[model samples]
Target: MSFTNKIKKKGPVDIVKPADEVFDNVYPTRISNISYESVIESQKAVKEFEDKDRDILIKNLKSAYEEVFIKIIEGCMLSDYIDTIYNNLPEKIKEDFDESKCISQLLNSVNIYLVSSKMGGDKTSDEREIPSDTVESIVLSKKELHDNIANKKFEEANKRGKLNNAVRLGCYIRDTKRYFASEGFIQAKASSIHSFEDVSEHCSIFLWVDNIYDISKKNDNPSFEALFTFVLLHELMHLMMDVFDETKFGINGAGNLKDLGQLYGYFREESLANALALYLCDATRNDALVYSILDYFVEGQTTPYQTGLLYIEKDLLKKAVTNWMKCKKGKYLTKQLAKEWLLEVTTESPRQSELTRIEDAIATLVP
Candidate 1:
């Protein structure tokens, strides 16, 4: 009946795509950090297989892949030795499909571990620069926003209002904490893990903020500023991931296995989003703010969203899994937002505007 219901019927198998397309470039964790010069030297050192050893090499490579799968089943990400084995396999030895893709998927799982909480973007980040928002631009945008809001053009006003706030905050953080580079950030708005857009010569981040009103609020630990700022920084990093690395995003078309051959796709965008948020929190030294998110990010509260619906509070994933399991072909699928029954704060009557609903959901999650 609903989109979330359709997904639950499909299951999680289609949730991930092969890393060669959706993931960051060749991040077979084993070789992710290996140097080009070293790779070159290794290439130079490749000796031709002896006639007898040819069969041995293929057997060994396939055998190693078998063992590798076993290790993966047990959750062990053995390093670049994986890359070496895959590359050494002659083209004819394997014919059905990619045996290595699963390995890459499992290896890239380490991307969760591979990113240092303190690391900024690579050199390309330094080279890309963000254009500063001038005071005139900021003032003009705000005035226009106020008029639009006064006229009840909320959607249009929201678009203009975020730029000044995002740009100003981004400039301040880059100057002090050095968490992000000087450029390649975008100011944007959205309700979910959306993708790319160009803004001020940088990619725009489409993250949802619970309360745009909280922009001017000070040091509210679990408030909108804390949540919005962190999301802002995280999305900027995602833009960079697109530029320089294979995004750890996954791909699973709607038909489930009907389209398994597709490659290079969307991030479990939220996975990278949460990861980036964790690091940005550390970089900003905002303990209380980051701790608030601990229930969701560090504790792995995201799996619930895979059902493609929304919820709130304890046992988020567990509830989602249960609901998903109950979903049936003939029944009307039920996917409820945690506060679907709650009254909108922006309204006095028992009615919810679409914006009110989105904002309320954001408040529930971010707070």
Candidate 2:
């Protein structure tokens, strides 16, 4: 019998549904109407749990966690492949899993679990149970999500390239938009391109196709889809930073503010953006690509001159997050004890200079 038939024979406990069903379940929401406010509130709530009564804090955390799951369910639905994967979960785990958290986290957790299982990595964790309020705020109705996908322009864009690449790009844009949106900002546009100059302010993303291919060529590996995915996430991080800075820090406060007469100010907002982006990227599914990128950095491998920007890009991301997390606990440079915290968190590596450059670049870009 065919794979589908065999999966069907395995019964309801087997999550071997058709790809379309899986896709639908994964991408259930539209790109519009995703607000940063909701995401901030969720994160803030997570932080606030520290001050709440223990029982209430756990309840609240569970609720916040569920919001992540709802996002995943929506994502799965959007990819049109919900049925194939749902049966793979244990009945108890599935029963306890919340369906209302940000679909991004849910999809991410599922992807991580699956990938880990396939690689013989640990996959014993249960789906995070979140509160209904958190879940409700993030979840979109099935009909609403389907309608949004139905209107995507990429359906046309996909028809223009090699079928597989086109489809991959299409899904990349869709998922990336969802990823950004889940963090609380709408993506005005997204596209795959040949260079950074092709990046547009109006569009939220510009995936560099040629650059990706060049990297794969250098690595002598033809399959660079995973690498490309990492790049896409990096770019998306820039977009997220832009949005968060504008909304949280005010227009003047967004980006680097060194020229604005602020001393040692580049580390605050920019660092936070980098940190959040990295955290989200790391937390998301398909992180092996991210791991590979980090591995290259750890090994001190540099890309060709033309491709050096990619390393800079990734390094800045690492620096941004590290700096941001430090800032959060009042350990920024302005804080006399910041260096101590930094030493505790990071290893003695040449990457520190790269992080400084990234902070400098952010100041230039935002100013």
Query: Which has the greatest TM-score?
Result: 2
TM-score per candidate, in order? Answer: 0.24, 0.29
Off by over 4 Å in 2: 1-203, 221-223, 247-288, 297-367
Candidate 1 per-residue lDDT, tens place, 10-115, comes to 2211222222232321111121222222221121111133455334333433332233233332232323223433443335433433554523332322221112
**lDDT for 217 (candidate 2):** 51
The candidate 2 region of ten consecutive residues with least summed lDDT is 110-119
lDDT of 2: 0.29
For model 1, the stretches where C-alpha displacement exceeds 4 angstroms are 1-199, 206-221, 244-267, 295-367
- Model 2, 1-367: lDDT tens digits are 2222322332221222222233312111112211222321232122322343323433432332343334323334223212212332235434544433222222332111111001122211222111111111212222332232234322222122222211111112222232222222223232322111112212223222333444555764423444443443333433323321211121123343222211122223323433433344355564564466555421332111112222245545454443432222222232222222222122223354654654554434332
Error of 1 at 2 (Å): 51
